[model samples]
Target: MDAANLEFIIQMLEQDTDLKEKIKDQVTEFDKKTRTMAGLLNKIHSTPTAQLPPLLDSVQPILASCTDITAVIAQLVPANQFWRWKDMWCNSLRSAVFSATLIEYLRSGTLLTLPQVGGILGIHPEWADRFTLAAEDYLHGLISLVNELSRLAVNSVTLGNYEEPLRISAFVKDLFAGFAMLNLKNDLLRRRYDSLKYDIKKIEEVVYDVSLRKLAPTPAK
Candidate 1:
């Protein structure tokens, strides 16, 4: 190629590299905040259900900080180039989604929809032409939620919160049923989905032990 053409191409590559570095810095900050939130949320397994609201509330500021980082990332990435730069931030985004979903579920016992997850991250979920949380990432977060809930189930029983295990068993089974309807083609998703059965089993075992030991409350007939 001509010298002028080579110079132009080199400049374009250097600009792209500089942009990627900036985005990566924001993503690193985002990941750090997400890890902090996750660590705080992990206390739920040991915390009493009555004391959970305040625990969940304490992480709100960190979550808001994560949202701000995501907003900065959105601005740094050029329009129509979200997919090209997504790999740099997708993992951190997925962890952020998991933290948000877990906090919501711990607060209300319901799953956060993909749109809600996007909202928590300060991104647009409806726009296909701009930065948004990918469906795969949301699903990955749900898979993580299931795994965490299973651990919570076992821990709850240890804390003598027998009813919590029963509740978790029902919720996880319902979630697994919903997942069964989707034709998941992603290998990671499929593997994660397969692992849900094990989680269900762990929860069921907890429920069974509670029932056998007469720890869970009997139904009022």
Candidate 2:
């Protein structure tokens, strides 16, 4: 990405305040639920082994009712097959892991500083050292999906035709005309992905800074 392109993309990202709010809302909702789950799990751990069975029995139904994973996934996937639901599922799992990690951080008050995301994400220190890699994976997946959808759209315009540029041009124009509706959806989806990845970076930075400050040695008298 050239500097100009990068700058433009950054500006585009900043322009969508409402989308950022929605992303924040989504993260907040997930965080709240994860915290609740963490507290419950902590309580479960604190309970005696002998008493655990009955306690878990009572909690199982409630936990199951709290959120329907399948339903949520269904709601997230677009109807089009080219949109890559599999990548969404993969990223969702990663997000869940991050959420769980955050919940653990809150419950234990452990200093999960920077230089530690690699370990959290199961990446060795020698390999790579930031949450941005995870975000890159997400962005690449979404970009591939969008490119595939664009290709599919192009293919639909040229289907079963040869040596007829005029006919293809007319049909392609019509196809694009219909595809115009996707413009806003594409912008929104891209913005959401970018904002989310950016937010992940911010979270990592904040946690790291806080952890380091907390872990710093006391000053000499």
Candidate 3:
């Protein structure tokens, strides 16, 4: 082949401009869905824990929409570029994770396992025939929740709930430990992992104050 002809072929393959724009358009929709969810879940932060689950009602419809968008994105991007385009939905994925975790946290004062997180994202983790996304993306979302829960731990103490802060401290500690177990290769995820330390410290401080004050509600002794 002539030099100019070979170079043109390389540029055509490399550009894949149509596919890039298609991915971009879908990602824009994903971003909107994420912001919508983030806004809805934001209400959860201020909401009394008792009333939290009901607030999840508003997010249910959007979760369905986000799930559909995820499936479409999976089909649009080639396998080679899957993870790259998938990264675009991390915010939405995390928001879904946050919503589920927050609902679980407020309702039961516990964190959901990654499989459970998959349930929130409407995908199966069994690696079966139809699994469209990875559990790792949703797990990253939980990291964001750890940050949210740290503030909640402090706020819980302010709200006259010593027990919740104690729970938050324990939960954040566990999440911190879990993040440490993974040999995370993603630079952005690793950086976020670094921030967990500060959240851990914040929760610890709250726990310490709660215990020191003897304000932490203990079973009748």
Which pairs clash in model 2? none
* Candidate 3 per-residue lDDT over residues 41-153, each given as its tens digit: 77755677677667877776786776676566667766556555555655666777776677677667787887776766666443233234465666677887888888788
Tens-digit lDDT string for candidate 2 (1-221)? 89999999888777545444543454455455544544564453245434545654553443343244423333343344313334433443344444333333323423233334334334333322211224433333333323322332233223421212222233333433433444334564446444433333433343344336553233355
Spell out the clash pairs found in candidate 3. none
Model 2 scores what on Cα lDDT?
A: 0.38
- Model 1 is weakest, by summed lDDT over 10 consecutive residues, at 122-131
What is the alpha-carbon RMSD of candidate 1 to the true structure? 1.6
How do the predictions measure up, each by TM-score?
0.94, 0.27, 0.79
Clashes of 2: 0
Sort by TM-score, top down from the best:
1, 3, 2
Candidate 3: list runs displaced more than 4 Å.
Answer: 1-15, 124-132, 219-221
How well does candidate 3 match the true structure in TM-score terms?
A: 0.79
Off by over 4 Å in 2: 1-16, 65-221
User: Candidates' lDDT values, in order?
Assistant: 0.85, 0.38, 0.73
